[model samples]
Target: MGKCIICGKPVDGLICEFHEEDVVFEFEGTSPSQLTPGRYYRGTVDGYADFGVFVDVGDHVTGLLHRSELDRRLESLDWEPGDTVYVQVLDVRDNGNVDLGWSIRQADREFRGSLIDAPDGEYRPGERDAEDESSSADDDSTTADAGPSTNGGDATPDEPAEPAEPAATPTMEIEEPDAPLKRTTVDALDDQVGSIVRLEGEITGVRQTGGPTVFELRDETGTVECAAFEEAGVRAYPSVEVEDVVALEGEVERRYGDLQVETETLEVLADDERETVATRLEEAIEQQARPETVEPLADDEAVAALENELVDAATTIRKAVVEARPVVVRHSATADGYVAGAAIERAVLPLVRDQHTRDDAEYHYFERRPLEGTVYDMDAATGDVTSMLEARDRHGEQLPLVVLVDAGSTVESTDGYDLLEVYDVDRLVIDDSHADEAVVDAVSVAVNPTLAEANGGAVTSTALAANVAAHVNEAVRDDLEHLPAVSYWEEPPAAYVDLATEAGYDETAVTEQREAVALEAYYQSYKDKRELVADLLFGDERDLAAHVSEQFRDKLEAELETARENLETTSIDGVTVATLDTAAFTHRFDFPSANLLLDELHRRERDDGPFVTLGLGEDELHVRTTTPVDVRELGETVADAVPDAGVRVVGGRDGHVEFLVGERDSVREAALDALAETLA
Candidate 1:
């Protein structure tokens, strides 16, 4: 009988049943069947395979430590061949194969006491000494026949055999190699499959999958995926993140027809090594992200005039993708806004796919969100901030770059821009509205023809975005050739019309596509609906556009008929002023929104003389003027004339103002009287 080393309780072996897991055993037997299941054992690493590592428990018995049984990724283990490790025998199959499970306690000092599992029985270190002394004394009579002692001491027939020295504790010492490994580039890895190499670069992305964590490593030459495992579905190295400079050693292998590196050792570079790699990546990215020239999709004086700003905006978007920063696009909820946002989306998705190794990279890296109005207000910015912060906190992602299309050009969006600035987020604006000069100074890049004083007639937001998209990725130029014409409600420019015709879309086809997008844009004012929008704009479903357009015309014509019956017209200073009480006569929440109905009514009722259309709601009023009217100036004049009405301009780009609902009649009278004097 023996005592349990942990509790000092009397037992039949060195450990009791309750403390068997506490002590690690050294397997002294030579066959797989000798391994006792649920007992921890010391072993040596033999080699590696794709599924697991082979370990030699003794001279003749070998076991497999499968990747699934590891607490961390198999590749992340730094153990080389012949190195000592600790594992538990999970099972011994009938075919003489032993299965091993991971052991959290790896070192000899972690256990209560080390013991040997021999064919006879288990014994502690001191017990082995007593057995050696007994053997030498008992075998003295056979010394003459044996003639020599196996022990390292002289023995003669006349002299008694000496006791063997106290047996020493078994230990292993590993030596580190004196030479450093050779470094290799990602581009050169294809020729070195099945060979181990070292790499130094920046991590562009990190994604956790069902099996391993895939880190996208980028060098000056190219990019590749390096996989590391700590456990099933667990992150291999939690400290490493995107944009971190790293030195990695791994074996190059092919997985699912794509080249992947199985990481053996990964360390975040420091000091001089980090600086050298960072500078090289910076220089390469700068040269690749910026296009040498900006080429317009078609010959238009307006687009040519703002070439420099277009290039700058395109470069900013391209650099965001290369750096693995998400791109969030915000645009107005209108046909022109949808077309503009979709054009850029079409160009950016291809680049995201090329840069990332993940299958869902396009959706993760690029997003398009539609705004309720043509302003990036605090509500919109708050939603964006919440989502972006969540992504960064949960996934270790970099903050995104905000891109505004057909919006964010006026002073109302300054507060939203300021909120993003607090987090050091980048912003880019592309619009055709009369941009406020303050907006130009707030964002990183602003592309507006009005800022450049270009005289080309009626430059729509879609026109500007399409040219920028072409420059961002010229491969998608043919896909965007017809978008500019679809954004125009009336007669488009001759150049865009010809371009659309050459792309196989006629005038009717373009109009149908525009109307369909506008209807879908109204239903879900905030969601992206990427797939549905793509089908409407670029898909081959002709009947889809036709069907949606039919519903758009039906809904619009009915609203127009009801509005014309309620409209009241009067002449003020030789100008026709048409007014409709939208709150009383219109469907406030349904399709053919108050704004769309008013636009159609004005187009049908206008004459050669000066004309103005007004749609008055409970608390707001929409304005449309044949001549240029500064809505801001008009609101100031009316507010002063009717002080009790509390009138103020709420939306400058959309030409709308707000007032107290209680004094709706008084505000209406005062606004008309103010308009009479201004027109006169």
Candidate 2:
């Protein structure tokens, strides 16, 4: 055997058939020559690193380039594999494995590389491949091929297993049948609310927070809760997904907290049959939409950015949470309006827990502007401050000034104005012990002094340190001091106040008010606040936070707009703007809608695990759990549901879901229904 191809050895009898082939494409190292660097080549991208793309050209030989090798000017381009690109050979020292090269796509147009040269080695046959096949064939014939043996490959005594049940007729349609109650179409059934009629729908949600998987299963009519044990729940649909549409048979049992439509059975549709169901649902939703029109609110890129911004906003709100603090409670009469008296939208600055009532404030006001001789009365039992006109007598109109103060407390204007003397006005003896301790704690500082017409009727000598009015007319200034335009200090945030009192904290300590974010953490992490907000807002996906953000913005914008407009007309003379610095109500805005959507999506499928949100476009919407929610199907579904509705479709971020028109509610509904059908 002068020329035996297998093993490259001369042999005669029982020759191995491998190690022989017409051509052998072998790679040796990380060089260009080792690769089939043509316009198009096949290989695995084994590893990806921050530095470059690691390609398994073959034979465990990986060539690392600044992914730029695939397309040299990579920094200016977006490239992803399996994308087409050009390459050329440079060096391959170790046989044909080690390779180095440049991108043909990145090379100059004038530099036309030559074609690959064929090797000079003569034709040869290989026996290794055939031997491998033979061995593999032998292995395939073993019992293990069926799967791993249960008893160490040893067969146990065969036990008589029960015969499997016969398959039911394929076209099993779970339909709603008409009864004596009413023969109404589901569209018509809604009007017959109290009627006991059959309604067929697939399960949409299964929230088993504590025990069994309890979820709402709905169709054209409505949703109902269905519960099952752990075993039966898992066994019902081994392949059940979030968007699987399933038919259920149940009865309506509506009662607070127990409102549910019971289901006796849950049947899954076959894969081939689901397309038709999804298609039908899609058609229905489209039917409800404005079929021939849609306007893009924002592109994919814009929406992504908006989503990131939302998360940051939410985080900022969270950071603003603060512990409840001391506040004064006083009752005052609601003045006759027309004056649209004392309007301050920021009155309820921070929200306390619902278990407790919101902070209430009271301010005494003179009906007409005071002409310097205005006297007020202080009720001893109530600590109520009132003017002489409200003294309950006309001839004996002498007024008693109510003095309320906590000792050693200080109150001064932002301009460094002290008004301790003003709180020292004479008390005309309304009650024997009118100045009580309860009154002192509530009023931080008070000024009740007998002027005795002192030296030209001037005020002097402060009674307390904080009471600037007593010494220098410390009236704590009126609401007018901090009006539409007030000094920054006049209304500093609680956090900023801490900064103000701190040794070296001031406007210079933090960024400018306009440039600053409410959250210190975000500011600390992102050096550039504007860039951080823009980057997070413009280049991200809409997640769960985005949805909440949308709700928050929608609500907040409405509230703010209304308040701002109303404030323009209403005059609030006594509202202390600086008092709002300590208020924070972030937690009150919690809406479980986002979590609920995610939970619902998860219950429909086992793998979905928990709720996860992704921003598809500018909106943070639930992923369409249902399959085949293409644009066409979406239009159809909208059309069917609301015949002439102006519809806009958006791809889902989390699941394979499709949303309806521009209207948030309809889109949510269509997507949820589609999910029901998909994971039915």
Best model per TM-score: 1
TM-score of each: 0.72, 0.19
The local lDDT score (0 to 100) that residue 530 gets in candidate 1 is 87
Model 1, residue 576: C-alpha shift (Å): 0.9
Candidate 1 — which pairs collide?
72-230, 73-229, 73-230
Instruction: In angstroms, give how far residue 84 of model 1 lies from its true place.
Output: 35
lDDT of candidate 1 over 183-205, digit per residue (tens)? 89876887998999899888876
lDDT of 2 by residue, 400-467 (tens): 22222211111111011112223322211101111222322333233222111112211111111111
Tell me, what's the RMSD of every candidate?
13.6, 33.4
Off by over 4 Å in 1: 1-197, 204-216, 221-225, 231-238, 251-260
